[model samples]
Target: MSKLACAAEAGMLPGMFKRVVVFWALLVGAGWSAGLPLSPKEVVVVYNANQPDSKKLAEVYRDARNIPQDHLIGLELSAEQDISYDEYQKTLVAPLRKTFDDRAWWKRSKNPEGLIIPVQNEIRVVVLMRGVPLRIKPSPLPEGVKVDPKDPIGGRTESAVDSELAIFGIDGLPVQGALKNQYFQSKKSIREANLPFLMLTARIDAASESTCERMIQDAVEAEKTGLWGRAYIDIANKFPQGDNWLEAIAKKNLEIGIPTVVDRFNDTLPLNYPMTDASIYYGWYDWNVSGPFLNGKFYFKKGAVAIHLHSFSAEQLRNPSKNWSAGLLERGAAVTVGNVYEPYLHLTHWFDVLHDRLLDGNSWVEACWMAMPVTSWQGVVLGDPLYRPFLHLNGDGKMLAEDKDYLLLRSAAMRWGNDPEEFNKQLGMAAERLKSGTVSEALGLDLLAAGKDTQAAVWFRNAKEHFEKAEDKLRQDLHLIAIDRKAGRKAAAVQEIREAQARYGPMPEAKALAGWLDILEPPAPPKALPK
Candidate 1:
């Protein structure tokens, strides 16, 4: 069983018993909202004043995004990743509040809950540089208090600094577990809403300073030329709740003409799986980074956006070999998000919503905060928050030939969303003419999903012949093998499987074939005819 399924079966999914109560308390809003757009002017960049590199990164990002010069603020902070509560308030919170007050960046007034909060904020977004602390360690609840039943996570206090800072400007609310994100799933923007403003904070941080700088550059380049590549989604079939999110994402990508690989296996994409041209990736439930990422030879295409859904995926950002956020950054993912501590599943970012918003042209930070159930929790947004992967979706300027097929397919999909038959016909023509494995494989997957296995086989075969990468070709071969088995060509399927095993022995993909072989040719059944 998958991790999520096991947890659910074991009755260990936190807040499951009273999820309705928690959802009503935190997410009492309408259905998913449209993207809340942001401009560079509304952003404030923060960095550790004592660290020159931190300040330099802030400047580099600000200049790259054209943010206002005066919007930058620097404070002396601890060099550690985890900060104590008192240290957090004394060094980071208090100083930032003072800066906002002195600079007139916001107006503070008595909130109805009877605490001072930003009532009219000129700045609604914040960007933290690499050297700033990552998270705040948990503190004991004031004596004689028990866990809140209505909202189980409300009693826990450890959180990412970016998460906590989001609501620190809202009011002097006690730094507890999770608070209601009034804007979550709501169509209203902070300026247009009635509640006190909640600042949206993202960090341009990674394992190295150079990586941070490159992330900024990549975001800019991707926006101008557009991010065109396949999406690799690892679906941990743990439970329907998480599975639905990934399935929806794959469906959406298919409709939008982006080639996507949706792995239905309980685990992540196998090690060293042919994962070329990966511009987008979303997976979950691994304790730490694993699979192809561990191979050290697999690098995401330039300006790639990736995320893994482990509880402590972002626990540390300084070690390239450690957590999800750091490992992804080290391996060329330009944008990613994860939890700095144990963020319960319900409170974490809804990656499906994040993908939808990004496709709708929302900036990375806005998409993340817009999808999160609540801020002041444990999630942290890393990389350039202003990056929008689909901002130039339909445009074709001086982009490289490598991005052409993706642009062509995307433009066609956008133009033909209401008509599927016509869309497939056009895509098939493109695939045949271009002889692109990515395009051919995408069509095959779509066809397979539509239950046209015979048609899918043709495309899969074409993809196998055209693909250059060993893994890509093998992936197509697997698709063909499955189709052959479905068509009752068991002998042929078994022959091809053994041949592939011989061709790629000891590889993860070969291991998958071995699983298929076991199923097709099981151990000799006992001679039970006597019964």
Candidate 2:
């Protein structure tokens, strides 16, 4: 029967028969069709065309894989709209979904076996800014209290005590246990008497360096009420003894169950060499060796989807040479050529290639690390408007390089971070870049890491998109077959399982997702007993 006739007939069937018959017809028809075989898995990718480097990088992936021109989808975001988070999501994500949904190839078919996988691609840009200053209120002082500068205890100590008393007034002793409860009262009295001006000035000009000490003591006393137990403990541990400041702080905080420094406290320390561990410190060290220290930790916490080249030795940076960067890539990283007097030239070359591949709507991931200099010169340069997103690393105090090449790399990374739309775009790019039929297979590994069957199913669909060739198709099929057996998607997840087996052969993930789907989907009704 003709496909349209079969479709019409299947549509006429009542209830579940229509769905079952349609699916079977499509499967049988595909076996007889003369067209190129479909892949079991699918993939999608997203990118910003405004970034020349990103565009270039996509191209390189495409050329390397020999993807067809028509298969790629390039989505460009305007520079003005790209800077705003809301604008990027609305302008980019919405159009992307529409483009895929509108494709004729994705429409439901009469053939029972045919499946249409839904995927999306998008790109985003990020802009960075400097830290804003905190606002602090003035202190207050008591009346009829005069400072004696010549006293051993110091004029500042007496002034501060007097201020505390004035702020608290006669109600101070009674409210001692409920410091927080009394705080507003004290503040109210200080404000009413306008005692802040004199007390603040005296505190600032104090001869004795015991203000911090006194503050700690008062805080400790306040904790007796248990109203500020945790806060009091934390405040007391800020100052640590011993020559090694980092170790001391670490020890002190550890005792109080606070593993990291407070945001406000971190601001007080010098930007460079802030932490005690010099070798592992990100801000103070050179990028090549020191970069990994920060990268590893950042990836552990924030889950970096892409990686870049930093300051690895010359031997580790090149291909067809003594050093190999693939080890890092294998561990979910990407490298850029480093140490060239003109790093941008090399970076631009790679970016061009990557952009082309992404444009093809294939499945692929790119990584790059910039070797930012730890100098004020670099900071000043990065502060310019052009390098907004690449201003500084999250933990590092130094600014990133402001050059367009580096900025492009930084922009891509930030765009991908925690953004679902951007991730879908990259998946599309990965789909088109499967050489040796390995892209889909490789993606299965990442899907497993995701720990969500639905998400893995989406990724599998992306893998199948570019797997039209027999070898690529078969490779993807096997992966799906495996996924089926493990995840038990025998029914609901049958689409993914069957696709994987059809394209790649067998897949553990396909089996797993299928098993899970079966468990989730209700069982079919038993045959009628009456006969």
TM-score of every prediction relative to native: 0.85, 0.19
lDDT of 2 at 147: 50
Per-prediction RMSD in angstroms?
Answer: 12.3, 30.8
Off by over 4 Å in 1: 1-37, 149-151, 187-196, 396-398, 481-495, 504-531
Writing each residue's lDDT as its tens digit, candidate 2 over 1-531 gives 432343244232233234434544444454421112112112222335555543443344334334344434456655331122234335443554455456532322222334322222111111111110001112222455555656422222111111221121111122111111111112122123232211110011011113212222322222221110010001112322211323333333223222122112211111111121110111111233322222222211111112222222122222212221222222222111222111222221122222222212111211111112110000010001111111122111122121111112222233443564453344334334322122333234334434444555555555556444443343344345435544654553456544444543343222333343344454788888995
Scanning candidate 2 in windows of ten residues, the lowest lDDT window is 375-384
Candidate 2 is scored at a TM of 0.19
What's the distance in Å from true for residue 222, model 2? Answer: 62
Return the top candidate by lDDT.
Answer: 1
Against the reference, the lDDT scores of all candidates come to: 0.78, 0.26
